[model samples]
Target chain A: MSVSVQREDFDVGLEYARFVAGRTDVGGVALFVGQVRAESGQVAAMTLEHYPGMTERQIDAIAAEARARWALDACRVIHRYGRLVPGDRIVLVMTAASHRQAALESCHFLIDWLKTKAPFWKYEESETGARWVEAKETDDQAAQRWRR
Target chain B: MKILYFAWLKTKTGLGEEDVPQLPAGVTNVGQLIDWLAGRGGGFAEAFANRGLVRAAVNQDYAQPDTPIRAGDEIAFFPPVTGGVG
Candidate 1:
């Protein structure tokens, strides 16, 4: 039921604990955390830029859609912008439901949609220079299956 | 109308935003607008050379090629969403 877009890092353990704290109706919680990758030491850092107004709107809508489609008691989505290095957390999606099925599916759905739907673009700084990360066909295909 | 660019499009245009009070002749939709800009030559032309690589939104909502355009609205052009951690 909450979506946060920030330039700061987040703690996975802290977030997970806060998300399900005192929630008696929740039987299971599914979590997905995305962190910056080293990519064989080729990438030094990543800068994420987003449409200031549209990024939050799109993320909130994505979270809402997941809640509407799945039987979930609560959900949390957090995405970080600005510059980040390897090992830094980039995103988190958690879903809590009375059963594991809804929790797992909704968590997966949120992660997929956040990647394709959110208006954030990544710029990778490497040894040679910096370049915008290319969109992947596989990512599109992953999101496409949710439509069916 | 306000036109905003993002990512590589922003870099190619050498601009983040441009204000055009009126659409050029025959520019009545998103597709036509892109064509008009692409025909401008130089940076604009290069940015839009590959039609399939460009994506857009009208008034902050996802827009299609045939989406109607009118004065006083905002339009943004960018590449596909970078699908990764975020």
Candidate 2:
């Protein structure tokens, strides 16, 4: 399990290469990258904020749960903080397992849980002015299905 | 205890954090603490006026209204998370 909450952006190619290097036991890999939405030019930029210590711990716990539920060879979560413009990468969830089922399901599970459970918040600087993005009910429903 | 605010809560309260003095009697949980803070009026009242919109964390862990709060604890108040992928 690996989790990182940082201000710097990550390269998807490098992350995928790192995931596959010297992993003879891994037969399947799943990777998901989340980018900031452009919102039809209404949103100019977004400032992502999170509890410094708690955000990392929470994402780690989510990754740990994915490992517990699936037969995963590896799992990694990378979420960003600070100001970012539209189309910037915001998060990455990667998982590899001996089977495709574990790889896909665990990857989905980590992202779903992170959507609602993580401590990070987004404040948008838009044409209308600045406001915090409200949590969506759809996101909650997405996470609800994964609950034990 | 150190009380912290984030996102809109920081903007609403106009403060990032504040060191709170020891609590008086009968205030043991987060709900009561919020009530006390709201009673201070002005921005505190406005920030916590709607209980449904606000969420709290005790010692960096997601907490409920009944969650216990003690001295030296680090409490934070903020809205629900909106930090995942699109």
Candidate 3:
């Protein structure tokens, strides 16, 4: 279990390798990488902000819940903080399990929960002015599917 | 009390972070904190003018406006999140 909230970039391949290292029981692994995108029809860079202590706790809880929901071998969640520009990698989530279904489902569950539940905020610096991005309703609805 | 700012809220607040005096006895939660900050004039007032649009976290966890707070706790003020980029 690795959960880090940092500004440093991470290599998904290396992290995945480390996660599976010495884990003979693990039969499957899934990964998701989120990146800052240039806003559509806007000329602004992206910035991310998060609440320090609570962010770690909330994410850890999410991971723990996923572990309880599935039989997992290992899991890792890395999320970046501070100022970030377009194309920067912002978060990475990887999970491993004895079966493909568990690995895949857990991965989905992790990202879905993170999107709506994590306490991170985003701001886009645009030509008109800086805009704070709202948490998407679509993300909330997607997360709801997992609870059902 | 320490208050941290993030994203656009940081921009609007001018100061990214500040250490403020504890609110009076009855001002025990985020909503009261916002009302107090919004009364502080200029940028503080403008930043928190629209209380409904603001988001807050107490001691680093996402919290509602009515979340109770204690002294020495770190309260963060910002807008709703878009998400983390990988």
Candidate 4:
């Protein structure tokens, strides 16, 4: 598994190759890219803030857990830090497995776990100034689905 | 110890981060920490005055109001989270 938190943009093609470096039995690869939505609750732009050391560790741990739970051949998670505008890419998750089910399941697990587990905070700057958005109870409940 | 704030909480605190004294006695939990911080008066009280609107994390992990905190732990107070998934 590979995890990175950087300001520079990432290439999905390059990242995908690195993920399946020497694997020939990889029959499926599931990918997820999260972009800063321009229309979330009528917000203009969103700024993402995170703790340096803590954020990376939390993401890596979640990825590891997903790998352990499924028969994944490779897993990759990347999240960008610093200020970001609407429509900008925020994060990406890719998982590879011999079967489609494992790959897809791992991808779902990665996203759900990151939502509730990672140490990231976002504040939307709008006409009403900035407000620290609340973590919805729905997110917690969504993550609970993988707690087998 | 360092106290960090995020989003609107940071604006209300008029600070994004601050160096604070070590944890005081009887302030080992999130509720106690808020009560102690409320004594700072003004903005501190306003930012954390509403228990339901506030959320906390100890050492970078989501912690409940009853979560025990230790000295030197990085305590962060914010108005919950609103970031992207995956």
Q: Pick by DockQ: which candidate is best?
A: 2
B40 Cα displacement, candidate 1 (Å): 2.1
Best by TM-score: 2
Clashing pairs in 4: none
Give the docking tier of candidate 3.
medium
| Candidate 3 chain B: 10-residue stretch with minimal lDDT | B77-86
CAPRI quality level assigned to candidate 1 from its DockQ score: medium
> Could you tell me how far off, in angstroms, the CA of residue A30 lies in candidate 2 after the best superposition?
0.5
Q: For candidate 2, lDDT tens digit of each residue in A53-126?
A: 88987888888888889999998889999999988999999999999999999999889999898998888998
Off by over 4 Å in 3: A39-44, A83-86, A126-130
Residue A79 displacement in candidate 3 (angstroms): 1.5
**Candidate 4 lDDT, B5-73, residue by residue in tens:** 876778888998887778877787888988998889999888887889887878887789899887788
- Listed per candidate, the RMSD to the true structure in angstroms reads 1.4, 1.1, 2.4, 2.4
What TM-score is obtained for chain B in each of the predicted models?
0.95, 0.94, 0.87, 0.88
lDDT of 2 at A144: 93
Model 3 lDDT per residue over B26-52, tens place = 789999888888877888898898777
Predicted structure 2, TM vs. truth: 0.97
TM-score of each: 0.95, 0.97, 0.87, 0.88
Q: Report residue A20 deviation for candidate 1 (angstroms).
A: 2.0
Would you list the C-alpha lDDT of every candidate in the order shown?
A: 0.90, 0.90, 0.83, 0.82
Clashing pairs in 1: none
Worst 10 residues of 2 chain A by lDDT: A56-65
